[model samples]
Structure formats: C-alpha cells, structure tokens
Target: MSNLIHFKRDELSFQPYSGQPPERASICRLIGPDASSSMGAGLACFDGCSIEWTVLYDELIVVLEGHFRLRVGERVIEATPGDVIWVPERTPLAYEGDQARVFYALYSVDWQARNA
Candidate 1:
C-alpha cells in the first residue's frame, strides 16, 4: 500500500507549454503514475487564456473552483465547480478560463488505468 501524499495548489512541478506562459503544474506528491498505471491528482491554474491540448492519456477532471469552457474539436463544454469531465487519449482540447481559475484533475494512462 502507498502512503497518502498531501499538497496544496502551487506545490506541483509546472510544465511550460509552447507559446503559452506555463499554465500547468504536475502534482507528484499527491499522485503519480505507477508500474500498473500511473495516476495523478493536481490543480491547474489559468487566467483569460487559450492553449491547444492533445491528450497524453485518459483523464477524469473535477472542477474544484472557478469556471471555464473546454473546446475539444467541434464540441464545447461549460465547466464549473462540481462539474466532471472525461477525456480520452489523443483527444484535442483547449481551455479558456476566467482570472485565476483552478481545476482538480485525475489522470492515468491505459496500462495503469487497468490496474485500478
């Protein structure tokens, strides 16, 4: 069994996307991938911004706070606190958020996902 890891917003390692001033932070302490399948729980912070997303893996997103619109191909999803979204691998998506918006996300790759 793994011990629980705790974290607050801003504690994760930030990944800087091209052309966008770093909008993502990786929360390794609280969650991360494993041999069976890697899982992660992290918070994303955004401001009036837009960025292209090509899903790296499967994801389950829960809005912890703030609001935004998810643009995936031809579909648009309105997301707010308590909203939940499922994203498949290789999907294209982008986000436009209000000032200081944050979303709590749960993600895992195919291999690890099966271990659950």
Candidate 2:
C-alpha cells in the first residue's frame, strides 16, 4: 500500500448529514479505513442543533470555528476554537452548538463497516 495520501482543499465536498437532526450539520470525510489502516478523519459543521450518539470507538475532536457543547451523560463540556475533546468508546453523548466547525479523528478500523 502507498504511504502518501492527500486531500486538497478543492477535493473536499461537504454533504448533508444523515444522522438525527440532519439540518444541524454537514460532513466531509477525508480519510477512512478504505484509505488507511486503523483510523479515519473528517470535517463537520454544526448550526444550533443537537444529536445524541453512542460512540463505538475512541475519538479526538478539535474545534476550528465557533463553539460546541458536548454533553456526556451528566457532564457538559464547552469547547471553543483550538480545544480538543476526547471521547471514549461506548459513551453516550450529545453534540450541540451554533455555527461550529470541527476536525475529528476516530480510532476505529471498522467504522465504515458498521456505518455502511
């Protein structure tokens, strides 16, 4: 397998999210197991919407624009630009915010397998 991969700015195409409260955000996947071995990366933008999710793997998210509120059970974390949020597997969480943009890396090889 090749060791080099690149996603140029022009190559990114954000599409409407299929998850709950679809209007909340759009996502553009950059890398996945189809391109790598054990991890995947993507870009997401949210606009004043919240979605409850159960994570299946470890995830690292970095805010790039605006702010985001992550509710993990009873704990709520406010994330701003440059902030990194680490979410562990099997955690039930809710992501909500207004005009938020983030970069995320998920450590899971079967993400696509399950999502697909």
Candidate 3:
C-alpha cells in the first residue's frame, strides 16, 4: 500500500491562525510532524491585512489566489497566482495580502518546539 494521501480544498477545515486578527487570516494544516518528520505543509487564507513575524524555519510559499506580499527589511516582494516566494529561517518579515490563498511548505515541522 502506498502512503500517499489526497486532500480536497473544499474539505479543508481552517482554523484562526494564532496571534492573527480573526477576520484577517486562517490556516489549514495538511501535513505536519505525524505525516512528515522534517517538513510541514499548509494552506493559508488572508484578507487585507499585514502580519509581522520572525520565521524559525525556511519556507516556500506558492500563491494560489489573489495577491500576496512579503516585506523583508526595506524590500517588498509581491506575488500573484502561480508565483512562489522563498523565506529563509530567522528572517523578520511582514506578510500582507488581500483575499489571498497560498500553499506553504516549511522545513522543520518541530520549529516551535525547537525554538521554544
């Protein structure tokens, strides 16, 4: 038997992202530590909002819908559908978007545990 699993976008259950405004962002964790020991994958939806945080793990973000923006230092990177953004670990950045949906994969599913 194969370990492959398929997920439907419509069936995903999104939860409010911690520390984010309720109306601004939500996330659906598709793959985590239980599925992959070293990586995590998820879908995130964002409204017109900006969130600032420091990443503890390297991340790759693929824009699925609408527009997304990443602000690192004085530079701002923008993405649309079919665009991909790479964020290195320990980078301080601001995530901004308007009606955007993105798929994100990150190294280190245990980042929170390791950082804490």
lDDT of 1 at 28: 30
TM-score of 3: 0.93
lDDT of 2 by residue, 1-116 (tens): 67787788787898877563546878998887778788888998888887788988899999999888899989999999999999988899988878898999998957657766
Residue 43 displacement in candidate 2 (angstroms): 0.6
| Weakest lDDT window of 10 consecutive positions for candidate 1 | 23-32
Q: Which regions in candidate 3 have their CA more than 4 angstroms from the true location?
A: none
Query: For this target, which candidate reaches the highest lDDT against the unseen true structure?
Result: 3
Q: How many residue pairs clash in all the candidates, one count each?
A: 4, 0, 0
Best by TM-score: 3
- Runs of candidate 2 with Cα error greater than 4 angstroms are 19-23, 112-116
Candidate 3 lDDT tens digits, 29-74: 9999888889999999888888898999999999999889999999
What does the lDDT read for residue 11 in candidate 1? 57
Estimate every model's Cα lDDT from 0 to 1: 0.61, 0.85, 0.91
